[model samples]
Target: MEWLVPVLIVVALVVLIGIYLWATYNSLVQLNVRVDEAWSGITVQLTRRADLIPNLIETVKGYAAHEKAVFENVTRARAETLSAAGPGAAGIAEGHLQQALRSLFAVAEAYPQLQASHNFLQLQHAFVDTEDKVQAARRLYNGGVRDFNTKIKVFPNNMFARGLGFTEREFFEVADSGAVSAPPRVQF
Candidate 1:
């Protein structure tokens, strides 16, 4: 019965390996989903901010129609934010949007009437809220990326992660610190 024992041992090893692979694959799928959800959260916040921008621009435009360049810059940045495909691109777009918003706000600063408008004030508050949400969403996305990347890079998982279709996720970070050094001063 020595042959029977060796066969049983081989079967046991195969079963154990199969179990390991299954668990690892499932974990990776879960992490991938989490990261995607986190990214969606970021996108939602960004979209909210994008939607708020036009109203803000219109409000400012009523008071500062002469500031055509500022309005155009904000509009272009909003388009970039809307069209950005991935986290890296979105981060860069965010930098541009922030700078544009700052310039828009700077122009608004010259018009006390615009700053004091009820509509403008409400939009400003909404923009602030969206910015806060965007920051939170970015944190969640990057955290998920960090966890997923760690899982795929750890000893045994690393050997088969790529084969299983898991890959590293890009973190959302400002590509140019200088471009976004100062937060958009939305406050009057």
Candidate 2:
């Protein structure tokens, strides 16, 4: 019957659309998970660096007692990094923290005994290791953001993504070029 054929065609079309929608939703979910995981990686590195800051500050403080302003700056920056609400906020806070740390080490450089101390050298090595990890984690997070943003902005998927809760994610980046402009003046 002509009527029966038309009904079957309509049903087939509906089934196809349902399948497509399901696949798109799943893709979005997977991409969102990757973005979250990548962010966690960055946070882990941030936390590690935060944990190292106080010890570094104390080590330098013992030798550079007159540098109260530098110590205060580092302390405030550390708190900012810890309290930052998101990657965008954290990146800015981290840049300030790195600068404070540089000033701290720069002042420490004036003290020959402190620079040659076993404790100070060990701390510097640990800080350098954490900084490297942070760089790798940042790259991973940015890559995830790029993938997720592209998925939510492209055609077909974009058409349905907005209907869902899939929005573009912000990429994490350095707040200042100066943050990485100098290769960490680790000169003991």
Indicate which candidate wins on lDDT: 1
Per-candidate count of clashing residue pairs (backbone under 3 Å):
0, 0
> What would you estimate as the lDDT of candidate 1?
0.93
Off by over 4 Å in 2: none
lDDT of 2: 0.88
Clashing pairs in model 2, backbone N/Cα/C closer than 3 A: none
Per-residue CA lDDT of candidate 2, range 1-188, in tens? 77999999999999999999998789889999999999999889989989998998898889888899999998999999888878889878878887887888789889999989999999999999998999999999899899888988888888889889888888886688688677458867
For each candidate in the order shown, give its overall lDDT on alpha carbons: 0.93, 0.88
| Model 2: lDDT of residue 69 | 98
TM-score of every candidate relative to the true structure:
0.96, 0.93
At residue 56, what lDDT does model 2 achieve? Answer: 89
- The TM-score measured for candidate 2 stands at 0.93
Error of 1 at 81 (Å): 0.7
